[model samples]
Target: MADDAQGATTPVLPPERRTAGQEHVPGNVLVSIGALLLGMLLAALDQTIVSTALPTIVSDLGGLEHLSWVVTAYMLAATAATPLWGKLGDQYGRKRLFQAAIVIFLIGSALCGLAQNMPELIGFRALQGLGGGGLMVLSMAIVGDLVPPRDRGRYQGLFGAVFGATSVLGPLLGGLFTEHLSWRWVFYINLPVGAVALVVIATVLRLPPKRTRHVIDYLGTFLIASVATCLVLVASLGGTTWDWGSPQIIGLAVLGAVLTVVFVMVERRAAEPVLPLKLFRIRTFTLSAVISFIVGFAMFGAMTFLPTFLQVVHGISPTMSGVHMLPMVIGLLLASTASGQIVSRTGRWKVFPIAGTGVTALGLLLLAHLDEHSSTTEMSGFFFVFGLGLGLVMQVLVLIVQNAVGYEDLGVATSGATFFRSIGASFGVAVFGSVFSNRLADQLTDAFRGVRLPSGVSADSLAADPRGIQSLPSSLRPDVLHAYASAITDVFLYAAPVAVVGFVLAWFLREDRLRASVTTPDVTETLASNPVERTSYDEVCRALSVLGSREGRREIYRTITERAGYDLRPATSWLLLRIKRYGSVEPAVLAERGPVPLTVIIEAARQVEERHLATRAGLDLSLTPQGEEVAERLSRAREDSLAQLLGDWWGPDRPTDLVQLVKELNGELCGSEREQPYDGGPAQRFA
Candidate 1:
């Protein structure tokens, strides 16, 4: 029982808690998860897949001026629509919404493939983004419906791994599709994959009906979206499309300011604000938000421009550019995984962001030195350093924000933190584009001055079509390449100071005792995918489930047995708990459900019978009176262990709803005789 993040003040019991004697495990959990993963892959892959394709897209569409909007439009729509998707899914059900999202995404993808112009493609990308946001939020939320809290962590990691794999594969796949086929294939590829996911989800997925009453913050969502649009317009179009002092630019800046003020006022009164005003009051949340924003700004801005440099300045093919970018991806993955493990072990995390920001600043400076003549070794080293810095900071921000807020605030706080980062990415790409455009124009004019151009060849033409440089007289080509190199590296030089700001901000972050539930790093969160919509209860459950998973199954039973003051083997304790929950268990059925061998289960059964803890009737085993007492003790010990993991939240003044949730989760953890907790893999077995 916990407040739904959307707006429910009262706790609504989960379906399993409300139902009397039965639990609501999905009929085919793995199949349902497979469908969900596919949905997630669609969203995650889209974020990166388009980056490598953008250069080709702009060249084919003949609008280098509108290049950034291709990425920005999708991000803007997705960020604005994310919170609404979560609320709607909670009110209705996720199954229909998830399917609807897939349909919308596929339609947009089709439209984008068929687009004949840049404006048309940008518009279609926004439409795709609308559905993409739902796919991301709902996929994670639906996992809570199908899996119990104790096993949720094991499955959640799969989602994280999907994000990680997509981050690497997306660019490579995009390059492949664009090179071997047409650039349109980048959008077209989502069709077959999405269709399969749609069919599988419609067939295999199921969930209990949910009809929760919650207030949707319509005005607040609109105001924020309007504000983001105004700012992005000013950044993308101010200098290039309109004069900085032009009415269009000034009006947009003013409108953005007015919208920000109105958004704050609307959020103060709305029942369920898109982003709660109260959270900004928390120092840790505020600082984390700022730092997350800066991280996104630097990270995405560089990612957007680096490919342009590789493709234009270095004259690399799209496929080869993606291959060249692998060092950065590897660095990010290795650093994030390592930092997460270290934090989980030491419970000390303040050092990472500080080091991360400092190294990120250094990396940006290093990238600023790239030119047409820079070696592959030099470029790879700089890219790796930048990724390492990002990996260090990105994952820890979510952890600190979640650790800082109360349970009621946890859901909003987590989403809010990522929301700022998303917003920053929009700003970063726009601003980077603006700077590159303006600087490129000046560099081209300067390079072309005092030089005779062939008929119809001009600085403007060269700026718009990078491929045009190859046809230019050889003497003119170096100037064009240098213009591009300087323009791109200047973006990085400008961004380095932003990372420094984050590094300074890291100094003020107060390190609190890390929560047991949040100790394990979720790869999806670290990658900064769309903000997942979850309630306070669901958030805690995920963290705890992940923690429980980190402590292996055999280790968990062994610890519980010791805490319960029993000297029995871990397998015996597991058997007793199983019998107590299900009334009776057949050893053969238990063995079949388990990774543990038939021999191990039979040995456990024999030990219990020898100890007078169980009596056998045919193949079914029943606990004795003494065994019943021991089982109750083990159950309490399990509950106590879970509570202890909560740290301060389990104090004497703990809320009644939280207590109920803990008990409900405990019952679910021990409920199903056929289902066992995920213990890493099938190779793991109880001793």
Candidate 2:
């Protein structure tokens, strides 16, 4: 039954039991979660799997010069599409859009497998990225629809595991296909997995349709897309395809700045903005976005060069380089899983971000000290520290952002956090790529300054082909290896300060408490429709909290009377409501448990009878038919008002949780079983 403001009819089910989606059944949850994980796996695995096959792709397509574009195309497209997909899902239904993403992804995958050249492959990968962005953003949005906020940590951690597992598996599978089968299999593999995901979502997942009329913000979309595209190109192509100081890069940079100003202006005025400017007003949301961007910048920037160091300086094969990166992956998985359980059990999260980012800074500092002779154990430990820090920080930021906003803005908030991270990654890769190239060129030139070279061979030739260093005189190998090591170390040295900035930002994050329930879009809309009733409910919570038992009982009566237009006094209304909520009660029992005196209880009962609100049958008192209707109206009004006021602090069952908290507090006040103090220490600072 729907909650009515008039309180004319009351559903037998309590407010806590009702939510936007279907009732939480074990079978249904498993089915829905399973489908979502499959979709996530498909998206994450693609990012890494192609890395191992890039050399083979370059060889087959004869585009040795255009190799970076293969990855750049995908990253740019995904980054640009993320916000649009998120806003669209909020406006329309997510299921159809989600399914459409899968279909588009599968089509891109199939076409990519059939590509005959580098241009075709790059074009197809861009298409795949467009779909891949939706798969990621929509999957998170759908999970918000399926799970409540307090329990979302466990699921987010599991998704982190999917990313971790694919990080390890992607390169191995990519290598195997490139060596034994074919490089095309990297793209072909997604086709089958995506199909399975499609089937699962179609059969098992159910979501409510969008009923509200949406004003699509087409102008905002154009401006935001333009900003994202220009900024990403400036990052991706600058210092590589075009000089950083050249007209092409300069023009893109200027264009990006101009579009950003325009986008912000448009969002402030749009009725339904793609990314609401108001969200930045929330302290946690803004702080988390900043921290996420910094982490992405340092993490991805450092990661891009690790394999190069292993290959050129440490002399490891492509497959072994992947294996060598396992410490970070293992550390990420363990920390992510453990932190998730702790947050769910304790409901404290501030410490994770604070400590995690500090650890990240320390890890990067240690990595900056590495040289050609650094031990394997030392390198592994540094990688592990960085990964552990990431695991703790990344998932929690998403969780914090989701909880800060109402259901109406949940998708936009999640996407905004993701968008910043992606942009940071792009910037880190481009800036560091330039640094590595320049530093290596300088070091290689210096290393070969006085050395005699083979006829027609330059230092650049030996730098490009490491195998040529083997053919060089034994005396020169050390110098060349030292140059490669120093250049790579320079990359991490640059990243360490960036990670330190992230650590500093973590202190500013406001530790807002996580809510127990995911606020569904419907609840937000309901409150929006009755803004005045929402204010009344907020007043009821404050008034109820401080009032004595008798006063609190009377306030409850007053709240119901005001909403329902009833004229009953506290005693009569309270007596009537007691019967309605708790069913038939004997007069002796009512007197024993009464907040007022026994005389007051007896007098209230008599008044209720005189008003024909209830009747006496033997020792048991019950509401009459007319009394039942009045009681139902009172109950509905009370519930609706309270729900609007305290929804943020509520769990899946707002009424149930609220009642339980009150009872527990009352018991403690009376010196019953004392609740254990939370041992979170500094972590509990927010509370």
Candidate 3:
């Protein structure tokens, strides 16, 4: 289900549930998971690590006009490549593809570190984004291959934590490296970490070979990529590198429009469209996409410039700039976490995006008021308000989309939401860059009109090297700083209207009853760590697993026993299910598998034997003939109970794959010794 190119309409089991030639032991699974996490960290960190370093990088590399491309190139490549990687992994095996992605990322990272010019760094960053896309998609998909659906929730939080940690750490680390070490170390840092992951994956990761037929949608993918590229080029280069009406910019705009039409036409006929055009017909999805784009535009665009504002306008070190950005990060984290929790508890969600966008606009307006004399406290307050607004909206967009679509469109809708946000991010940076460059050029020219007497100190040089301002004549320094402050603040001033549009659109979103599967806060999806390339069945399983975990471990067996209509003790039912799954269970082996004491295991074994549900022979318990019948009934009951959690999804016409998934999950859930019930508690202890 996780590997399914389409949604649950298809009939592929999730990777971990597939029949394995050799089972992965716990230790091996742990080590493999570590490697995958490291890979994910590498991809996630790169998203933010370069922000604080961008000013220094531009100073050293000398193309201030092209600064946004460094971030834009990576985002564009990653967004375009994400779906392709998931589909390719589905067609071929994932292990080799995962390894290949790591190698490509490392190679790109190395080249990025070695880049001597802005163009070279931008090119290398795109190469890294190509691999980074795979790392983001496949790492999450691979988790499905390593752990059973019943246990997946336990690890999902870890992936979310990785993204959360990187969001804070990336900027700080980038600042430290740039201020203390060379800025080149920002790219070079991926080497040792990626190498460890590469080695660990090669040595420890193993999976059974599996393949499926898929229409790759190569044409649709290409058209979309081309369209994005042209549009971004137009945005980033227009009015800065070239006039907006120049032949080159006009050509790109026309080409982008044509490609977009072609993309829509192609998607109409493609066996599996890169992004299904049919999704637009769903009003909720369409509105969510628009709002998501706006949110990305405001959030990432603001983030890109804040560090520059701090370093240039405030005359702060890169490291201090990173530290100063913490208020926004904290506000974002707090608001997202709280909003998610509130939605999960109340099932109400429409208010968040509206409030978020409103606050975002207010924050942007406040930011526009910042000048060279703005206090740190005032700047931090504005940043916090902006982040708070973003946090309120970011996590809910995906959840609402998931609830809005039917089972058939689940996977595509989720990915589609993420895709638009990424595209918006790319556009945001480029548009912001275009605006900043044009404004800065004009402002710098005006400020230095007749006062410049230094031989080499011109407006162009000041724009290229912000660090050179320290050496400027005292009389000229204030004007230069004010020019930078206004240019950056004007970016936020212009962006506030975009946020207002989002606020208006947010009102149009018809709130739907949240699905039980979506109500549980999936930190991975909410945090945007895992690209949810999963079917409806897979998505449900992950959510239910997390829900079940939250319901308390000891109580799960009891609930299952009651739901199965069993009068037997929870421990007896668990033992019978275990024996039914494995054909035979030894008390000692059962004890070794979990924290359940030998005495509890023996007691459960004795209870089953007394009930004639099992027969003991040579310290191993096997089901009796009557026991077999009861066990089969119990298994069906367990599967039915699991199915009941799916709500309307468990209809009479449900797919065979879903039925199979439920049965597989039932076996795994019951087989987990760690979750075994201790009905009598400490009183039953033999020791």
CA shift of 67, model 3, Å: 1.1
- The weakest ten consecutive residues by lDDT in model 3 span 1-10
- Candidate 2 vs candidate 3: which has greater lDDT? 3
The TM-score ranking, best first, is: 1, 3, 2
Tens-place lDDT per residue, model 2, 208-319, is 6643356878898778767867866776567656888999999999999998998999989999787789999998888888887777677666656676676568876656
**What are the per-residue Cα lDDT tens digits for candidate 1 across 30-55?**
88899899999999999988888888
Tens-digit per-residue lDDT, 244-289, candidate 3 = 8999999999999999999999999999998998899999999999
Q: What TM-score fits each model?
A: 0.91, 0.67, 0.89
Instruction: Give the better candidate number (1 or 2) by lDDT.
Output: 1
Q: Which stretches of candidate 1 lie over 4 Å from their true place?
A: 1-26, 552-559, 566-571, 585-611, 616-621, 651-657, 671-687
Number of clashing pairs per prediction, in order: 0, 2, 2
| Candidate 3 C-alpha error for residue 52, in Å | 0.5
Q: Which candidate is the best by lDDT?
A: 1
Top TM-score model: 1
Q: Please identify model 3 stretches exceeding 4 Å from their true place.
A: 1-27, 450-452, 519-532, 535-537, 552-563, 566-631, 672-687
Query: Global lDDT for candidate 1?
Result: 0.83
